[model samples]
Target: MESWLEKRWARPLYLAFVFCLALGLLQAIKLYLRRQRLLRELRHFPAPPTHWFYGHQKLLQDGKMEKLEEFVEKYPCAFPCWVGPFQAFFYVYDPDYAKTFLSRTDPKSKFLYKFLMPCLGKGLVSLDGPEWFQHRHLVTPAFSFNTLKSYVDVMTQSVNIMLGKWEEICGTRDTGVEVFEHISLMTLDILLKCAFSQETNCQINSNHDTYVKAMFDSSKITFYHLYSFLHHHDIIFKFSPEGHRLQEISEVLQQYAEKVIRDRKKSLKDIKNQDNAQKKNYPDFLDILLSAQAENCDSFSDTDLQSEVNTFILAGHDTTAGGISWLLYHLALNPEHQEKCRDEIRSILGDGSSITWDQLSEMSYTTMCIKESLRLAPPIQSISRELSKPITFPDGHSLPAGITVVLSIWGLHHNPAIWEEPKVFDPLRFSLENSDQRHSYSFLPFSAGPRDCIGQHFAMVELKVAIALILLHFKVTPDPTRPLIFLPQVILKPQNGVHLYLKKLSK
Candidate 1:
């Protein structure tokens, strides 16, 4: 009886040990497989030096773009280059490969967009397939010309406020102003007035200005996501300082948006109780979004509403400012071109007047100048796409699936084959007569196809109004000492911030 009991107990213990041993071996195998895949992906890449443990993390600490330009230029059209052990990417300097990647809406090409996922959410920029189609459809109406027109009075109001401040300063001496900072606030004011129906003049804040600080914090996080390939992975992001700051800023902005949305909803409810055309009178984007929400109760949640607000605020504010600043920089350097645009603006609107959208559109020379500025200094400098299936390029080189390809805007714009005398600032290239002869995919400042910028029309309107207002009051001359230095951010902006001597024009 004792011997039988011993054998029974031993049998159970032995089985338990075997099971544990099997699990241990399986885990070890899984880890080994993961490392092996990382190694294999990295082996095909152009090798950068790494520490014994951390890999190429240090190379991406700062000045990432400067290093990346060197890599892209050196390789030209190489596939699957390593930033570190975790990433294997492709760089496409060739126009043909770039076109294929940018135009395709396939599932594979969509994965390269994962970088934008955390910051932008699965918004239109990050989404693919059915989700993308649905979101794109729902959002298209918000950017229509009629909807945009409702916001013009607000844009004009904001510009007048900015110009008032500028006039105060420039009255005494030749005010050497940093135009980027001025333009930045002008667009911010426009976004606030249009989207949230609030006025936030961030240029001169009485308080410590937490809102603008949060905005800069959010912007820094976006900049980090764009270029830091190795740290862009989920694991590294969780531990980053910027990552923590992003969460905080997101919370702050979310709360602020919720308050505005809630207030708007309450106002609409009150209007409904009263009845008639009073409710329909409100024309701001906030009113439009709230109206849509009321009609389609099942469509979007508070999260979605907040995200759209954030997207518009960020997109509308920076892009328009970047466009105007670069245009001024180009015009400042080229006085003949400056005179041409001024002459055109003067001819169309005359002095001491406001511009309507139709009037702005009719100013052909001004439009050409804006188009040319976008060509040379595109606000969004590079776009990245991934390959899902192995694809062959026009040059007959093959790129395997899962490698990222960066479309170099600077390279493409500078390519002599595409544009005549590509370096010179010539708005004439975009004139109606010359536009027909231009290549279809050559000029992609706002990008091309369905995924291009939604706020472009709004941007153009804001630019025209601001530019017209500035020119009416002040004639900008570059200080002879400070020639414009090209400092590239997410937008190609002036480094010294377009220091110009503003002589107030007599009425």
Candidate 2:
């Protein structure tokens, strides 16, 4: 009887051991597949020597723009970057290399994007394979040229609202306003109205907006987790404090998006009750998604709808906010370019408060200034991809399938060989004559590929409208007291708020 009792306990313990052994073997196989697929043939390819065990972990952890610049200067095109012993990533800055890689049907980096998964949940930004293709195809028409044109009035109204608030705030005080604090909220408010046809009045309450705080908090955490070796493991990360915080913030963000989806879905059902005639006539992005879902269930589900919309809400707000904030700073720094852009806007609008769809086309100088700013401080400084097939580049270099590829849009834009005095805020470089002389892939602010930003047209239009209105009413000048420091966030943004002095202009 004693023997039987002892044997019973041993049986359960043996089962547990077996289970663990199986799991461990499975994980080992996965790691082997990942490493073997990304062959170390490219390990000997040009790169700074590693620390043997940690590889380039220390260098990457303390990584800055200087590191990126040095590498680009030395290699000029493509070079390997080892994040750790396991990670063998390749960095490509050459336009030709960029063009070639972009042309391929490579997927987004699986390892790096895991951080975004809890928040984004397989959204357009993180999606890959056939799923990504279908989602991109569905959303492409939502940002069509005609659709973007239709949004002009909504964009105008959103900008006008922001400017009106700015007028009151800047009326008596000579003290300049922080550009990011104002611009980010304005963009969020505009995104809601444009995407789901919901005016969130985000600017009014943005200071206390939990969603905004959560998003920015999550973004910083993501950057931190990017370099942390332990955070890469899902099992360990989930038990950590950062992971707990990510979960809490993700719930807040997801709930907020759920509310947006629910409200819009209900409003569409009772379309006749919508009091605003203008808003009633046009179908917003949500409406299009809903229509598609009803027609074909397989194409888009409720989960997919929420993910895509939330992706846009997060992406559409912050990236544009960062881009515009930097754009304003650049314009403020270069008063000459600011005046030229203002002159172009005035010639087109001519004291008219409304920025018509047709007038936007005439503001060529303004567009140039915007493009130059994007080049100087591209919101998304770099993008990473993973190859599905082995490929050879035009430069006689080849990399195996499944390796991580970092496309340094920031590096390419700032490359001295590709650009003349790249640091200078010279909008003239983007002039039709000059721009044509430059390589196609040299200036990839929107990225260049089948997977390029879907809302590129929308973002450009929104930027033009905002800049036109802001410049028309106030001349932006850099705050003499506060200097800005750029940091590589989820998007490239100034470390602190962007401070700019705005002198209201008389018509």
Candidate 3:
């Protein structure tokens, strides 16, 4: 009996030792192969290096936009180069190349955007082919003209809440106030009211607290994933602190979203039982989303519903909020321009309690201001596309499959070749006569073509209403102490926030 037991234990121990030895050897081989590949790649395209084996890492670490621009300009057409064993892109600034890659119909988005797959899942933005088509069809109805009009009251109420808060804080007189945080909160409230019928006050509170803090952490994690080693295909999340934080935030945010979704679903179920004809009394976007059930019901799933809710919350709140913040910041800096915008608002509404759809259409100058603000400080600063199939641009340069391309707003918007005096803030450039002479893609703040922003109409309405109300109440002036600086992160935000004084205008 003793001899048999010893024999069994001996075999198992030997196998375990062999397994350990094999793993170590495999790791060593992988390291050697990676080093060889890096050296081979470096010979063709030489990347600038840093001392101490850092190799262009400091530039990445700094995250300064100017430094990044310099890096882009160093290479031909601002293409990003790799460093050492890890393959990472630096910058891509060619417009022809951008159109070729981005316009391609493929699942090529996965290569560069692997980091977002976990957070966004297989939602419309992250999908391709039939799955993307089906999902987009189902969700598009939520943002339709009639559907959007239903939420106008919610938008008005949210804006009213913001104006009231601003009045209370600034004491109904000429007082210095930063508008970024207020705009951010106002947009958040509008999104919540329209999308989910929930509300949270984030303006008066330290803009750096709680929700904003969580978002900051998440954005950092997003930036960290730019390195190829930290990509989705690899299990690098296990070793990364940023990845861990991303996961934690995902859990926290999803829980919050799920709670709201559950409540909205319950409310819709109750409403459905009462009356099928009472469509006008529907709750909000959540109600429409829940009721979007089709006869086939094949396109919709529990996962799809969850993903849609998360997408709505993020996109609805962030993009509009960012645009509004930029508009406010610009208005604060240029009081003469602000006066022009106010005059336009007054001409259209004439002290009306709310801006009707017809009146919103008449505010052409206000629209021009918003357009120029977007052109200068577009909320989505960059968009990426990875080449899935070999394609030649209009310039005749062929991009090989499996390379990434980017349409850089930083470069494109500021290009003097496209816009004469591009640095100047001129809303009149958007006038029918002026814009008709420019290229369609030259001033695409909401982008162009099929992949452009879907919520643009909704956002425009919200901004027009909010700006009209704010202009009716106060005259914005920049605080001499705090100059505005654009801090580009996930969105273009003010570094110190938009600090300005408000003078109460006649009601």
Candidate 4:
């Protein structure tokens, strides 16, 4: 009787196992069909040969840039790039296509950019629709020309500090210094002073500062999360080591922002302190945020404050540093253009004095070279958006609603069809006569449209100030021994750090 009972139970268990196996097979077949439907929908766009399961991931594993360029050359306007069997997006490089897509009011790609929301906290970079509009409207005044003009002094001081450090390094070492490291810290210093009026001396104490270290770590972790397929799921990533580390880093960043807000709020409670703050040359970004909060506590909460603060801190410093580093690298590689830019800067700021607001516009050639550098190596190589409505490109290609489109800024800038000898670093391309003749969307380092970078003006002013001061003080040349390999992360960072020899010029 016991043997008979065991046999009956085992039969049920075996049946249950078979049932589950069939169910799983059905789900797999469903998923495969859905992917095939997507592929058919994208049939109008050509793609490189892809594996049945791995897609383009294997092809992109080595020499990603070269493969991308190859695709660009073979395809016209846009092509579908599959990340896996189930995921794909059109890699759009044509200026006309970019202009058409960017002109729309589509939200950012939820699948791609949502990864940043945990780190950035729904700031301008991630927000959409009414909420994004509200936040943007509230913060717009902080980046006004008057406020940016007041920031010039702060930028000058920060640049001078970096240049001083380089001076000391030049005295002792005949070798090239890794500029990206110093530039990153200096940009962080500048952002701190301009954003919060706080001086942490990060450039000097960089190795020891936990906040600075956390900031860099957060960027790396975010980039990792973006590319790791297994970590795409929230629950899976939360249990992983990177996720745990990211959580810790997030807490550190949150704590830092909170402390600054708390201190500023406490000081503002004092009437004397408020009066003094009002009497200052101009209020910093934090002051403006606080003022906005005081006016509309219901609209702008502490959470919003923290998000914007963290967003500005991370986005501001890193991107600006990349732009400055690449611009200097390009200038180093092309000394003739570098010398011409120096002459323009020298003419604007005689005796190598502080770069003033009015003089910034006078450095026309310098500005052109900066634009050229941005074109060749845009800090943010690509941006993505999800279509809310079906749209047809100028070339008669169309994409349905809900499709994700990646605007390849790097590809657009380097397209031979849009530019003559695109790889050549020629600043004349940005000259007024030449610029007016080219497509407006051909060069978009800061991107284009309503969602373009809000801090672009602030970034431009900072770039001009830093480049002017550096050019005035040193003759920069590329380190022949350590060639740069472009690596696209959160920004287009060099795989190896940007190494340049800085020879201090006699005053």
Candidate 5:
């Protein structure tokens, strides 16, 4: 009786083991087929030297910017790079290759942008297909020419407040002042007042004790998580210390954004408030999101509203701050160009403190310098896109579907073949005659094609207003002894804060 029972149980156990083995075999076959297809597509492309385990990821982690620069220079066109087992890229620097990629219906790389998903959510940057188009359409009106022109006053107010502090403190300091510190705060203040319709002065919190601190802390932690080996795994990242702090900081940002949305909701309900707000002629960013919600409740929610606000705040401010700081730096290094820009501003404004929309449009020389600065040090240096479908280039070369492509903004701007003497800080390259000579894809600090930055016009207006005011008031010169290093962070930032000697111009 005991032997018969043992045989009955053993029969069931044997069948279970065999079933598990068959499932494993099937999974192996699927992986092999997928990997084989990818390899076939990538077979002809050349890549930089890669490690067996580290691949090219170590270069990012070890802070090897020079090595990466050398590789890009050597292969100043389409070159392959491996991040890991599945993370491969044809990092393209050639303008033609870039145009081909940009022209297609490529999606943002999910693996590269994984870290940002926690804070930015599925805002315009992450959204795809009909959802992306819908959100983009809703927000487009807020950035119309007439609407952005009105925000110049707000930006001027913020810049004046920053300049007041700079003249009092930084102008008196022996070694000039840290430009990035002051400008970053001012940009945040502008973003809150103009974009969110929140009138708080983030610059007043100079010590960065409030939401400004949260922004910096969270960005740093998220960038760290992006490059970390262990944290690449979501499960592992969740249990890590950096992950914990990111969660805490993200909550602070989201809660702050939610507060703004709630306040705006209350204001919209009041009849008297609506009349006064209508004087601005156009709705702010918050209003657009809320209106989208009313049209189709399922399309945009309170969560989406808060997420986009946070995304804009983070994306808009940090990037512009870096761009403006770099602009001052380059102009300072080239005093002749600085004086010319200042002279142009003076010619247009003629002792006027505030800049009109018409006057802002007429500052051609100043705009050229700004474009040149952006080319040399684009705030967002590199961006990635993944192919949703196969593409055949003009050269008859093809890239199969499901590959990530890196658009190296810095590389294209500095390519010798594309730009003559790429690193010589020449603003004349942006002159109308010279600019028209280059390929459309050559200077893409704001990127190109369908998904180009929507806030670019607004950004240009703000930059012109702020720089025009700064030049009208002060002369900026780079400190010879204190050189700055531009690091590739969430935005390109100087390793040591940008220190420039701000000499108040004689009236």
Candidate 6:
């Protein structure tokens, strides 16, 4: 009786194990077939030798950009880069190919961008089709020339605060200061003042501000999530430690945005007149978003408002910080160009005490240097889009619908086919004569076409103001010991911080 009972239990357990093994094997076979199909479809585009299982994963480990550049050199216009056995994207660096893809209305890649939804929600960065168009229209006025002009004084004040901190640091630190950390805080300060009209004193206290800490931490975590395949699924990531931390950060950010919105709404109610409120004070980015909601109650939900606010806070501050940091790095590396920029700024503003909107345009040489820096170290290294329909490139190579394509801005900027001695820092490359001769899509630091950065104007203005003020107050020189190793995260960041020695200039 005991033996019979044992056999009965063992037979059922064995059968269940076999069933599960078969199911798993079937799933594996299905994925393998899908990989084979993708390989066949992308056979036309030549790619570097990739392992059957690992694909190009090993090659991209330590120095991703260096490996990418090697591939860029080998391939004429575009090439296929596989992330895994079942995934690949066409990395297009050529101007003509870039134009072909950017000009289209392809939706952003869902697989890549969906991870951002938890933090960003359905903000402009992730929206598509009619919803995207509507949001873009509503937000465009917030960045108008007149609106941006009003923020110059606020920007100057923010820059002054940062400069004051640097002045304090220069007195004690002879070893050189890491500018990226300081600049990141300054940009965040500026964004808060300009976006919500709240002064967080992030640049001064730095460590005491929870919101600022959350914002920076959130950016790092978001970048991690983008690359971590194991944490890609929503259910799995939500339960993980990193995911829990991200949730905490998101809550802090959202609560802050909500509070700002509530306060602003209450103030608007007291005014009782939208136009009068606008006439009294320049409407901030948040005000513009609120006004849009007032005009169309059906659209721009509360969630949408908060999402846009969070998006601006994240995208605005971080990207600008990276751009400014790299610009300083380039200027430090090339003193001649730096001096030229200083001379031009000195001629415009004697002490660089203040910068007006009109004066920003007058810094022509400085603008060229800024453009050159952007070309070399674009804040956004690459942007991907999922093709809504079959599309053919200028080279006659085509990708079918549903395929993802990555427009490599870094590759384009550094492509030897586009620019001569692309690695060398040459501001004259952006001169009017040379710029006119280049392809329209060849140099796209802000990206090109319909889906370009909405805050490009705002960013340029802030960059000019900060660079001018800093250059006036001190002479910047690169720290030779801390060489920059480019780490392409969500924003292009230096693996080692951007350290520069500052010598205070005589007033």
TM-score quality measure for candidate 3: 0.84
- Those runs of model 1 whose alpha carbons end farther than 4 Å from true positions after fitting are 1-81, 107-119, 233-236, 276-282, 480-496
- Candidate 5 has which clashing residue pairs, if any? none
lDDT per residue for candidate 3 within 186-213, as digits (tens), equals 8877776777776565544636445445
lDDT of each: 0.69, 0.82, 0.68, 0.87, 0.81, 0.87
The true-versus-predicted C-alpha distance at residue 220 of model 2, in Å, is 1.9
Instruction: Give candidates' CA RMSD values in order.
Output: 5.5, 3.5, 4.3, 2.1, 3.6, 2.3
User: Per-residue CA lDDT of candidate 4, range 1-507, in tens?
Assistant: 999999989999999999999999998899788788778889988888988777776654332786787788889898988777777878899999999999998999986677777778878988999999999999898899999999999999999999999998897445589999999999999999888899899999899988899877776777677666567689999998989988888888888898999998887777565576555566899999988988989999999988998888888888899999999999999999999998888877986666778989898999999999999988888999999999999978788897889999888988888899888999999999999999999999988899888999999999999999999999899999998888777677778899999988887
Tens-digit lDDT string for candidate 2 (290-361): 877777687688889988887887878889988889989998898998889888888889875777888888
The TM-score, computed over Cα atoms with residue i paired to residue i, of candidate 5 is: 0.90
Candidate 5 structure quality by residue, lDDT tens digits, 1-507: 999999999989999999999999987788567556666787777778788656677776655556666776787477777665545677788899889888876888876677887778778877778888888887777788877877888888899999898778755444488889889989988888877766676787657556788877766777778666557889999989888888888788887887778877787777455676544444677776787788878877888777778777888988999889999999999999999998898999987576788998898989999999999889987888888888877677788778878888878887878887777788889888988998989999999988999889988988998899888888888888888787776667788899998887666
Model 6 CA lDDT for position 212: 86
- Determine the backbone clash count of candidate 4: 0
- Model 3 clashing-pair count: 3
lDDT by residue (362-395, candidate 1, tens digit) is 7778788888998877777766666667777777
lDDT of 6: 0.87
- Give every collision pair in model 4: none
RMSD in Å for model 3? 4.3
lDDT of 3 at 344: 82
* Cα shift from native, residue 214, model 5 (Å): 1.6
